[model samples]
Every structure is written in C-alpha cells, then in structure tokens.
Target: MAQAKGNALGALGKLTELRQRIFFVIGALVVFRLGSFIPVPGVNPEAMTRLIQGGGGLLNMFNMFSGGSLQRFSVFALGVVPYISASIVVQMMGSVVPSLQALRKEGEAGRRTMTMYTRFGTVGLSAFQAFGIAAALQSQTAAGGAPVVYTPGFGFILASVVGLTAGSMFLMWLGEQITERGIGNGISLLIFAGIVAGLPGAVSNTLGMASNGELSVLRLIMVVGLVLAVTAFVVFMERAQRRITVNYARRSGGQRAYMNQTSHLPLKINMSGVIPPIFASSLLMFPATAVSWFGAGHQSRWLQGLTQAIAPGQPLYEIVYAVLVIVFAFFYTAIVFNSQETADNLKRSGALIPGIRPGRATGEYIDGVMTRLTGVGAIYLVLVCLVPTFMQNYWHVPFYFGGTSLLIIVVVVMDFTAQVQAHLVSHQYESLLKKANLRRN
Candidate 1:
C-alpha cells in the first residue's frame, strides 16, 4: 500500500511538471497570435486587405508566414522570418569565417555568443525590411485608389521600422523562453503555430468555394487526399534512419577481460530536418519580396520579367526552389553531422566499423554513406516541396495545404511529441530512482 501511494505521488509530480511546460508553450503561442491582430500605426486596414487579396504571389506567402499579420499590417508583420534569416546567415558564416568557426568549437559559452550575434543580425535585418515595407506601402493603393498608408511620411517610416523590429525581437525572446521552459524548439514551434493557425480559414475558404460552385467536390476530395498522403510521407521519411554497425574491442582490467561489444550508429535519412525548405524559401522570397515591395510602382520591363519568372506558381520559381532545397539539404546535413567528428569519437571509444579501419578510413566510409543518403534525402525534400506547388497551379487548390507548410506542421508536431515523451520517460526514471533510494534507507 505504501509503495502504491509513493508511485502515485511520483506520477502526480511528473504530471504537474509536464502540465506546466505545456501550458507555458500554449500561453506563448496565444500571445503571439494576439499580437498578430494589433496593426501598425497609421496604416489603413482595408487598404492592406485589398492589397493582400490582389497581391496573390509572394504577398500571400508572406501573409502565411506572418499568420495573416502582413495582411492586417500588424506590428508583428515581419514575423520570425528575419530571425530565421539571421540564423541561417550566421550558420553559413560559421563554415567560412575563422572566428565564427572557432566560436562554434567553444562549447556552451561560444554558443551563447553566437546567439547574441544572431539576435543583433535579426534587429538589423528586421529594421531594413520594415523600412522597405513602409516605403512600399506608401507607393501602394487600394483598388479604389486609396493609399495603403493613411499618412505616409518619415514619421510613419520611423514608427513602422521601430514597431516591426521590436515585434520581431519580442518574438525571438519568446521563442528562447519556450526553448528553455516549454516542450519543443521555440523558434520552430512559433513558425508552426503561425502556419497551423491559418488552417481553419483555409478550410472555410475552400468549403465556401465549393458551395459557390467555384470548386467541385471531387477537387476538394483530391486536395484532402493529397494533404493526407504528403503528411504520411513526411512522417515516414523523417523517422527513417540508416544504421551502421560498429564493433568495440574487448577491454581488459588487472583481473578480468571483458568481451567485445557491438553497437550501431543511426544516421537519420533527413539529417537536415525542415531546414532545407525553410532556407530555400528565405532565399527565394528575399529577392521576390524586395522586387515586389520596392519596385512595385516603378518596375522596369526586366524587373517585371524577373518577378514573373520567380512568382510562386511559375516554372522557373519551382525549378530554382527545388534546386535550392537540394543544395541546402546537402549543405546543412554536412554542417550538422560531421563525419570526421563522428569517426574520431568512435575511434576514441575503441569502436570501428566491421570492415573499415578507424580514423580516416572510418571517416571516409561514413562520408560516403552520408553522401548517398543526402542525395536521396534531397530528392525527397524537393518532391515534398514541389508537389503541392504543382497541385496548386494545376488544380487551383489553396497554397495553405502546400507541401512546405505541411512539412513544417508535421515535423514540428513530431518533434514536440517526442520531447513530451522524453520528459515522461525521464520523470518515470527519476521516480524509480527515488523509490529505490527510499527502500535502501
């Protein structure tokens, strides 16, 4: 009876901790969503809406990332894109810049320093983007010819730059807090929340179109089926791994010799996770966004051609996007999973692949395996990202159900669920340890 009571109490303690963390994450997301509604000062909401409705190319994508904040011209209109861009820039720099590379090898303190630099980069990027947005808004007019900005001036530009920058920084801080205290990766969860929050509206829009005879029921069914299929595919690919067998030689003490042990190193099929898609999107969107925002009114013929070529549904856009995804998949996979480091660690532990020598040979073996795996992974990412674009273009399906959004949603949920399970397992282990201690006493 006493043991039963102790176990129950321990379970209850774990439940309390898990509940607190889940609540913190939910609260942070709620705050982010609420902020999405608070419009930037001196902006005409109706004009902004009209612009979004008519600006069906990159603006739609921007609004999706912002959780409709861009359509509302909200303070959080920049969303976390600036921070994501900053992080990618910093990470890429780490590979080429000696100082950054040194910092990467410095452990926790070094990581903190890198993070500080990323935050500063986010601020600068957000401010620049915000000023461009303000200038763009000044040049934009609604269908009825009303200015998107009610009072466009230097004051409005300053206020917008400050508001948008502050909002993005606040989101960055919130993401960090979530990472420290919540269930999953804070930045990923934030982007996940933004994307997922728009689902209901997307559903409503599709259904409404169907009701109005604009969309056939068959098409709707097809769209739903495609989304479900893509989601399952993503889950499978994300969980798939290749296991490499390693053998550790026997270790001898003064008295006894231990037998050799065997283990396997598991390399995930998609070692880069959703990073390739995110990075590709950022790179593709930057130029498109800049052209659309800055050159909207005074676009030259070449500028117009460039924008048209890179628009979301265009062939060139799809091709470039696919190529970028593939390249980033290999690049990011290389950065995050260093074959040399893994081989060195295995060697230090007296472990070696059955048919390969330790050190350079092991590294080469791992690298060769990684190269092949990365190629497969890159193709998978490209297909997953581009398939939805084709569906949207040919079938007129909404972009909300696109492959990129679905990938982010599915991956983030998987990660969040895994984190929760990890916490539960850790809690149960602690309870067992405590009970063992009590019995010993």
Candidate 2:
C-alpha cells in the first residue's frame, strides 16, 4: 500500500511536468470547437438545418462524428474524414505497391514521407468533397424557395474548397501536436471530443421529444441502459487478450552464467480497435453524401440498394458493417503485428515460445495464434457494434448510442489511460536511476 501510494505521488509529479502538453491539447480542442460554429460564407444555416433534420440517417451519424460541424456547414465541416480516407488508400497501396511497402519498412523516415503523402491526399479529397458540397448547396432550396448559397459560381467553389481543405489541414496539425505532446491520442481524442460535444444536444433533444410526448420515458430509459451495457461490453472485449509465454536463453559473457528471462506476448481481442468502423463509415458516406449533394434522386434499384447496404438501422447495413469490421480487424491486425517478423525478431534475440520450434515453425504457430485471436476480436467487435442496433429495434429507441460509439469511447479511454501509466512508469524509473546515480557519486 505504501509503495502504491509512492508510485501514485510520483505519477502525479510526472503529470505536472506534462502540464504544458495537456494545455496545448486543451487549446487545440477549444479551437476545433470554435471552428465548428463558424459557418461557411454564403451558406444558409436554416435551410441546411432543415435539410439535415428532415431526413436523419447516415448524415446524422456523420454529423455526430463531426460534432455538428456539418450541420452548421462550418469551415471545418468536412472534419478529419479526408485524412482517414487517404490513410485507408495508403494502407491498401502499401500492401500492393512495392515502393510503398519498402517505404513502410524504412522505419520513421518512411513513415514521415507517407504521412506527408496522406496530407496531400487529404487536400485532394477535401477539394473534391468541398466542390460537391458547394454544388449541393447551390442546388438546394429553402422552404421559402431561397437558395442556400448566395451566389452559385466558381468563386464560391474556390472559397469553399480552400476553406474545407485548410480546415482539414488545421485539424491534422492539431492532432499531430496533441499526439506529440498530449496525454492521449490526438486524433482519437479529437473524434471523441466531437462526439461528446454533441451529447448535451442529444440529451436535450431527447428530453424535448419526451415533453412533447414524441418519445416515451420507457424508451429513454431503455436507451440509457443499453448504452451503459454496451459500454461495459466494449471495455471487457477491448481489454481481453491472449497471453503467449516466451523464454529468453541467457548466456555467459566471460565466466559468469545468467538465468533465462521470461515474458508473455499479449494479443488484444480488439486488435483493430475503432479503425475498421472509421474506415467503413467513411467509405459508405462518400457515395451517399455525393448522391445527396448531386440531387441524383436515388433512381436506380442498385444505387438504392447500395445506399441501403450502409444506411443506419437496416439489417443489410448491419450485416455489411459487421462483415467489414471483421475483415478490417484481421487486415489491420496483420498490418500492425506481422507474425513472421515477430518470430524472426524473437529468434534473433535467442527467445522462443515455450515448447515451440524457433524459426518457420514458430512463425506459423504465431500466425495461427493471431488468426484465432483475430477471429475472437472480429466477433467481439461485431457483437459490440450490432447490439445497439438490435436494442433500437427491440425497444424502439430513438437514441444513436450504438456499438461503434461505445467501442470507440471505451477503447480510447483505455488506451489513453495506458499511455498515461506508461509515462508515469518511465518517470518513476528515471527518478530511481537518478537517485542511484546520486548515491554512487
């Protein structure tokens, strides 16, 4: 108990040292929030609001993710979506493109280069999306028949394109700064902050619905209960891991012999974390978003079905979402943890899995283990994601607190806490080393 208290005090001291970093993150987030309210020039906020409220589906989900930035048609309306999409493309390319794959293997320098390319790609995506949004605004009409855009022209297009791309760049910079200096992941925290910002509004909206007798109290209770249950489930699944024992053979360096060291490899159940859902959501949003903007009117059966395949609350949508989650879980886990590479590294370091051969056999064994772990991970993700949808149907709830949001919230919190603990541990170790050095001197 005394030791634990000492460690806690040491952690607090280390956190004090990180005050500047914490403040930087807080400042960046405040800037992001402020940007969300600064509506784009010449855009009709009322008309946009009505359009969003009229038909709530994927757009609503996107708006939730953006922290209501899209609803306001803010300069930062596009959010970090473009960058995420660009990352997906880059990841795919890394698998197929030899140069890209080689770059990925080149360590930090290569990663830096890839990040730059992603930023460039984000600009391109932002421009395209901005034009689409601009065109959509120009075409849309208010209830009173006034246009959303004051003047539909090349100037509006250029301004909006620049504004959106610049906004994304700003957000990117904020995220990077946060990651470098903040207590948690800058990007995930940004997204989490955005979603959380919408909570008050969502709650108020729900209460308003209840007052007007549009939503029942029972339904509201069910929604709250379901959210809590889902949050707990996500935490459990996210924390689940497979521990593989490894033994390191120690050798004598002169006349002295050393005992073997042992460790365990922990393979997390949710290996992909929230990444799969983010990708799935972004990819699905693009065409539907384009169609809505284009006023394409959903003519073809195939197009309609395609849109339905990703629409919220639909079985088809849920199924596809689950499948995508599973696929990306395995895909991302493979990318993040290469079994062959791990095996090679372990072998090189004179470490081996207990009762397992040390080379190709070990690699294959590790791969098999990963495959099973990923399978469990995939199911856990799917279950966490699909439960909310089922609850909505069962209880006729109107709230949007589903599996994806819950999973994201839980996983991010866990990871952030772990990172803070790591920082604290490192600080403690440094202090101990310093004390020993002082004693020696």
Candidate 3:
C-alpha cells in the first residue's frame, strides 16, 4: 500500500511538471498560429485567398509548411523553413569542412557557436526567400484576374523583405525558447504544429468533395484507412532497433572482483528519424519555389516543362525525392552515429562487442550493420512519403493524407510521449530515494 501510494504521489508530481511543459508548448504554438494570420502589407486579401484556393505547386507546399500563412501572404509566410534549410546546410558542412568537424568535437561550446551560425544563415535565407515571394506576388494574379499584391513597388518589396524575415527570426526564437522551457524539440514542434493545424481543414475538404461527387465514399474510406495504416507502420518502424551485445571485463579492486557486465548497444532502425524526409522535401521544393518567383503565371516553354517535371507527384520529382531521402538518410546517420567513435568510447570504458575485437574491426562491423539498417530505413521513408503521392494521383486525395506530414505527426507524438514517461520515471526514482532516506533516519 505504501509503495503504491508513493508511486501515485510520484506520478502526480511528474504530471504537474508535464502539464506545465505542455501548457508552455500550447501557448507558444498559439502565438505562432496567430502570427500566421497577420497579413503582410500591400497583399490583397481577396486575391490572396483566390490564389491559394487555386493552389499552384510550390505555393501549396509553402502554405502547408507555413500553416496557411503563405495562403494569406502573412508576415510569417516564410515560416521556419529557412531555419530548417540553414540547419541542413550547417550540418552538411560539418561533414565536409575540417574546421567545422573539429569544432563539432568541442562539445557544448562548439554547439552554441554552430547554433549562432545557423541563426545568421536563417536570417540570410529568409531575406532571400522573402524577396522572391514578394516579387512573385507582384506578378501573380488570382483565377479571377486580381493581382495578389495591390501595390507592387520597391517600397512594398522592402517592407515584405523586412516583415517576412523578422517573422521567421521571431519564430526561430520561439522555437529556441520552447526547447529550453517546454517538451520535445522546439523547431520540430513548430513544424508539427503547422502540419497538424491543417488536419481539420483537410478532413472538411475531403467530406465536401465526397458530398459534391468529386470523391467517392470508397475512395475517402481508402484514404482514411491508408493514413491509419501508414501511421501504425511509422510507429512500429520508429520503435524497431537492433541491439548489439557488449561485454565489460571484470575489474579487481582490493580483494573483491567485480563480475563481467553485459549490455547491449541499441541502434535504431531509423537513426536519422524525420530528418531525411524533411531535407529531401526542402531540396526538392527549392527549384519549384525559385521558379515560382520568376515564372509566376508566365513561363517560357522550357521553364513550363521543367516546372511540370519537378512538381509534386511527377515521375521525375518522385525519383529525385526518393534519391535525396536515401542519400540524406545515409549522410545524417553517419553524422549522428559514428561507428568509430562508438567503438572508441566502448573501448575506453573497458567494454567490447561480443566476439569482436575492441578497435578497428568493431568499428567496421558496426558501420556495416548501420549501413544496412540505413538502407532499409531510407526505403521505408521513400515508401511512406510516396504512398500519399500515389493516393493523390489516383484517388485525388489531398496532400496531407499520408506523406511527410503524417510521418512528422507520428514521430513527434511518439517522442513527446516518451519524454513524458521519462519524466515520470525520474520522479518515481526520486520518491524512492527519499523514502529510503526517511526509513534510515
């Protein structure tokens, strides 16, 4: 009874802490969503609505990422995409640049410096993207022939560039604050929030389509069923891991000898998590986004052809996206989990892999295993991302059905749940320690 009571008390304490964190996250996201509705100066609200409703390729993707900010030509239209892009660039550079690689070895200080650099890069990228968007809006006309921007001039462009850039930076700051004070990764939570915010609208749109005969009931059922299946698959795969056994030699201290300790080094199947898909999506969207700036409504024959080829669900686009996801899966896995470093750390701790030598051979073996795992992981990501594309092409389902958005939603929810559980466990441990001390006293 005492133990059960202790457990209850511990859980209650942890629940209180978890509640605070959850509240902080909710408040931050509420702020973000509110900012998404504040339109940029000179943008015609009605025209913006029509353009968004029409849904061009790049514009749709941007709107999705921005939580519909781009649809309204809001100040936060650029979103945290630039920050994500900057992080990708900085991380990729660490693999190739000797200085960065050395700095990466310096621990927390180096991480702070790298974060500052990423912030600078985010500002620069946001400004560039904001300029492109401003220019594109100037040339863009809705389906009803109304211009998206009422006043297209240098003044409008300058205000947009400043406003959009400031909004993105503020969002970046909010994400950082969430990471420090809230639960889960702040940037990821921001993206997850944005994606999830559209769920209600997606469901409504699907129902409307079904009612209007644009979509059959069977097709809607299939889409919903597929989304549930994909989400389950993602959850299963994310939890899957390969455990490599490690043995630590017995140590002798004074007259007593410690027994050999056995443990396992767990390597997750998807070591790169959602990063590969996010990177691939960003890279694939870049060309289309850039083209939208110069060729909003009017495009040359070649430009038009290129745009079609790279548009979502296009054969060429799918192929490139899959390839990029695979490549980035390997690349990010290598960066995060270095087999040599792992082997070295184990060796230093007097541990060795079962039946493997404690040096180069162990590293090679671990690397080979990781390579195979990453290959499978990459294929899983590609399939998960492409399933929605296929559904959209054939069943004409919306983009949110089963792609990157679904993946992020599943992964983030799993991660957040895990964090909450961890906090609860810690609280329980602390309670047990206190009880033990009280008994001794």
TM-score of 3: 0.91
Tens digit per residue, CA lDDT, model 2, 1-441: 765576578667777877766688788889999999988788878888877665355667767778889888898888887888788788778877889989998999999999988988988998898887787677887567767778788888888988888888888888888898787878888888888887787688879988899888787777787678778777777777799999998986766676788999887777777777766665665556555555546365566567767776777777777888888888888877778888999999999998899999899999999899889888887787777678767656556565667776777788788987787688879778766775699
| Rank order (by lDDT, best first) | 1, 3, 2
- The whole-model lDDT of each prediction reads 0.88, 0.79, 0.85
Q: What's the ranking of the predictions by TM-score, best on top?
A: 1, 3, 2
| lDDT preference between candidates 2 and 3, better one | 3
Best by TM-score: 1
lDDT tens readout by residue for model 1, 229-323: 88899999999999999998877776667768889999988888878887788677766556555655554657666767787888889899989
**How does model 1 score by TM-score?**
0.93
Off by over 4 Å in 3: 1-14, 53-55, 250-258, 283-291, 296-299, 310-314
**Residue-pair clashes per candidate, as listed?**
0, 0, 0
Off by over 4 Å in 2: 1-15, 55-57, 142-145, 208-222, 254-258, 282-291, 296-302, 305-311
